[model samples]
Target chain A: MSQNRWAQQTLWGWGRYPRVESLVARPERRKEVLDALADRQGDPVLAFGLGRCYGDAALLREGRVVLTRRLDRMLAFDPETGWLRCEAGVSLEEILHTFVPRGFFPPVVPGTQFVTVGGAIACDIHGKNHHVDGSFADHIRRVELLVADGRVVTCGPDEEPELFWATVGGMGLTGLILSCELQLARIDNPYIEMESIRVENLEQFFEVSAESGHFTHTVSWLDCVTTGKATGRGIFMRGRHAPAGTTGGLSLLSRLGRAAPALINFPVDGPDWMLNQATIKAFNEVYFRKHPKGQVNSIVHYEPFFFPLDAVRNWNRMYGNRGFLQYQFVVPPDPSHKAIRLVLEEITRSGLGSFLAVIKEFGERQHGGISFPAPGPMIALDFGIAGQPLFDLLDRLDRIVLDAGGRIYLGKDSRVPRHVFEQMFPELPKWKAVRDAWDPGHVFQSELGRRLGLSGGQR
Target chain B: MSVLILGATSRIAHELAHRYAENGQSVFVAARDADEAARVAADVGVRTEGTCASGRFDATDFAGHAAFLDSVRETVGPIEVAILAFGDMGDQHASEGDFEAARHVIDVNYTAAVSICELLAASMTERAAGSIVGIASVAGDRGRQSNYIYGSAKGAFALYLQGLRNRLFKSGVHVMTVKLGFVDTRMTYGLKTGIPIAAPDAVSRAIFDAQRGRSDVFYYPHFWRGIMSVVKAIPEAAFKRLSL
Candidate 1:
């Protein structure tokens, strides 16, 4: 390693808000990462992987951030069983590009494929198929973690389950994940038979989701600007892996098509008033009216079906230079649906509508102690960072979500109070106990962990 | 078909290794640091379908250069392209007062480079094929008061490359010297150069293009050629009087 390897850099999450300056060390090897951690630098350190989270979950602020991008490498792969072991820095896109043509795919993939495996595990990210396969942690077989004492330990569901569960969704505060073994799912082809249904309201969305339970993937786009009878009206999409021999010659074309880089990119942030209520309402109206009333069935590549937003690089720049905040929360699966209705009503009444609100149903919760997904209906909305009013509105929405037995996704959150966080995740104490046992000195710390009082005695 | 990159762990060299691998060329990466070399090898291997391997190599260890080349040849076959990218820009102020420091800089930048180049030149000459790319710096064009110690070493290395180029011209061997200006790399991390800095990606692309073209003493980014020409044209009396 060079004598002067650390460089001060400004970093932010994909949301692009709440930027912070940090001393970053890009270690190219496992030994370098270990040496940096053991050097007794006194500054709290966090392992950063691609910085795909929408908030400070991956940011350390004034602390040290060990960038793991250079450590990306495939350690081992079992072609027979489709089990792969790779460094934590390997990205989902890399994995897909290598294995998709070979008839295998990651079981759980979030909206974007640019995230690293470590970041996906840290967030325990859920995807369109969460209602069937659960979150990313469900497919993880084992993980090697570099703890505070510089000891590398192998943990899994049956081995060191406490530490494993805590580290899964621990926001990378427990330790730096060195590597992980994942169970990849075999697929016939890369194409998906997709069905899009235009729903009239929130109730119709629930009905459509329930009807599409047999489908491998399901998600709904919500028009948050619609009021009264048409509130939450939008398009519902369900997809299944295209049957064997259906794609034929098109499979190769699909693979090559997805490999092409995105052509449309938002080079700069739009004006502050670009995503205002008036503009969002107009967009939502046009989007809702654009889709046909009946169900539309089509065969498309999995990339477009699963990661549509990725087709337009830097899509978040549409929110403008001030950046935006992604407020995603999940409410318990209640028959009354009162909680979700109240939240949507509050958003519409605030006169601030997000053109990118998405609603999905989550299945049974995984084993991760702090995992975000549960048996619930979740909603994710993006709002421009317009100051106090936005915070106040989010606070009010948080109360309704809390009353309905819901918690916000930490990966997408930027501003939830400590008390609210504590209330939402009652298992925090258990996660803390496991973390303290692994890292007593609080060596592995981040701004999100600090903000939520998850750093134990150090905070 | 095969490329050998000495000092493969350096930011620019590492990127260049990946570029070659992605282009379907086999890569053999060697560096003084075994762990870093292995990491680069693994990264390049995973990113491309081409064969990749790595070995430990110390530029200052003259005796090890021949053995390193032999090992690479045995592992990945005769290297079609060999890149010399190892050098240190020592602390100029400290080198001015410390003879040992100055000697170390000279040895790394010039002496060690000469030893490796000689061994590589002999092996490639015997094969009657292959290209050698030396990553020299534009600082060698004209010495300045700020960093003459490092600049003088680069100057010597560039002159040596020019001589090697002339010797290898008739042997079917290509010798290309990459004269780089201000590059945004770890070596120039925080130093404000006042010049428009080129990214390592651009520099690596230029190096690849130079190797393919078999160009001798080409300036990276193309514009550096004009800039260095103007600097070299300045009279010594006038150049020494002004702070550059």
Candidate 2:
């Protein structure tokens, strides 16, 4: 390996290796990133956010990888409309910490807080409240995209709408998300008025989540190892931000001003062998016990309610060396919801029961043709790489997803088959048409783009 | 057979899991996060069965080491092979006045591995059929200013692994020591640019080769062996003058 390219050998995701050349840049401003893009005439360029998206979504092979963490800056926030504007490199944690105390919260937030807004927009991340609020893209009012050309272009629903939609879930293939204007939600308090319900199987989970959807936000944690009669057994969590006077009467200002402990390392990178069934089960049991069955508890903090896993620094290292894969997919609302059961069954039969299995209801039609979400039940599970079986099992899952008119989240995928992608995403040609319009040279690309034939020699 | 990888969640450990699972070997990954371990196991095609749980583990939880091993044994059954891949190198200068930093480096490297190996080595000795691999660094051979604090811990581990190998030589249990130079991992991400670094895949392959060949000690990159030998032979008085 060349001396300069050594760092590219591993990324934040499952140990997917990408061979990059000597050129690497950390652009503190959008101009630098765009200038670097212009400097390389033919070589593909990828904008690296917090490097949180699992897999090669941000990796550009033999090309330049632009680190955008330092480009963080908050431009504006309208309290009345809950509209906040900021640079792409600003993380969700920054937003929450800054605005949540000011009576505002991000419309959608993934499980982790380390991800950059650019990454969030690229992934169009959905959270437990996806059934209500949709994705990160849903809240985005406008985006300043640093296109293939050196010029910066503003895109939104009305202006360059196609580019805006494609760039939302485009996985950084279309262009770099330089800055974003997002519509946040007004919150009364920092803590969620949380409630937990135990679901016996897949049927109950769907029933509870649907019923809980009538309220606001809902999510479920399925026991993946539960087999036979108790298959898909787990807990369902439902919540809304507590009213200002409900609990300790904590104000939004107090919560926003509080700073989290300085990040030691990304929790996702914790050593591999840190957790096991007994310990996880115990932790899960405690977590469950903390919120008794149907007990309405008024929690008063954002950290535990939103990012509980963040408490332990470097938690991902717990997975040991094998690393982990996040398999997140959404199925359309079907007649029987058999697709969800089948996917769970497949995971069970494969004997790869993830420790954290999250099931949520997706409320919006997937934006960007090939993006992973639709109007159905979304299931996300964490899997550690045991070898080829994971690939084979995922292929089977892709087949199941495709057959059911479902799609895998490209942001979280590393081994999705090209055929499966082609079958699932019919909008590739249209997006390609728009992308080609912006720059026929195909300057912005990523490993995910290359792997699935979204960009490169074959395409 | 389920292989309980102690440090198996490292880059090399992850690669070993992938290679073994490709050949149909069952893997049990134990790490700090059960979710992450399960994820890795699934990704590598290994079933997260039995004691393949990821939760809080202090490799240097000396008093609890036996209990930890027993817990793993009870959950995952007999570990056919256990590879220790859990050492990290912190900044040497920063560790000078900080006892917590020094202790953390030691705990993660020598103390943690030794604690787990005590139980593993005992079982392997009894079974007379197992292999234990440790990824020690060539920096452990001779200390330097660059990373001597982390290097000292590895030095202790390397010596311990050598002793374990000598003890297990006739017991039919194999213990291999890997004198790794620098593998590009998160630990070395802060290193100055242009440093010679080995890729995770290359280091992983060397690990797999060493495990299969049943070698006691193998220098990764093989070239590191010659380079380290010459470096070690240099007079310390002169070596101290030049910044490493």
Query: Which candidate number has the best lDDT?
Result: 1
Q: For residues A1-459, could you state the per-residue lDDT of candidate 2 as single tens digits? A: 111222334344433322234346665433456676766647788888887777778877677787777566565556678877777888888787677667778888877788899999888888877767777788888999888777789999889898887887888877878888898898887778877787777788778777776656778887776677767777787888877776554434334333443443454554544555455656655655565555354564666666766665555566766767778887788868788778878987786657777887888745766566678888888877757887788888888888998788888787787878887777878877777788677787777887787766453
Superposed on all Cα atoms, the candidates' RMSDs to the truth, in angstroms, are 3.2, 20.8
TM-score of 1: 0.92
Tens-digit lDDT string for candidate 1 (B89-121): 889999999999999889889998999889889
> Can you tell me the CAPRI class of model 2?
incorrect
Ten residues in a row with the worst lDDT in model 2 chain B? B46-55
> Which stretches of candidate 1 lie above 4 Å from their native place?
A1-4, A38-40, A243-263, A456-459, B22-24, B182-184, B190-202, B241-244
TM-score for each predicted model, relative to the true structure: 0.92, 0.62
> Quick one: best TM-score, which candidate?
1
True contacts kept of each: 0.19, 0.00
Q: lDDT by residue for model 1 over A334-440, one digit each (tens)?
A: 98799999999999888887869999998876554667987889999999998898999999999999998899999988889989988888788889988988888
Instruction: Give the 10-residue window scoring lowest on summed lDDT in candidate 1 chain A.
Output: A248-257
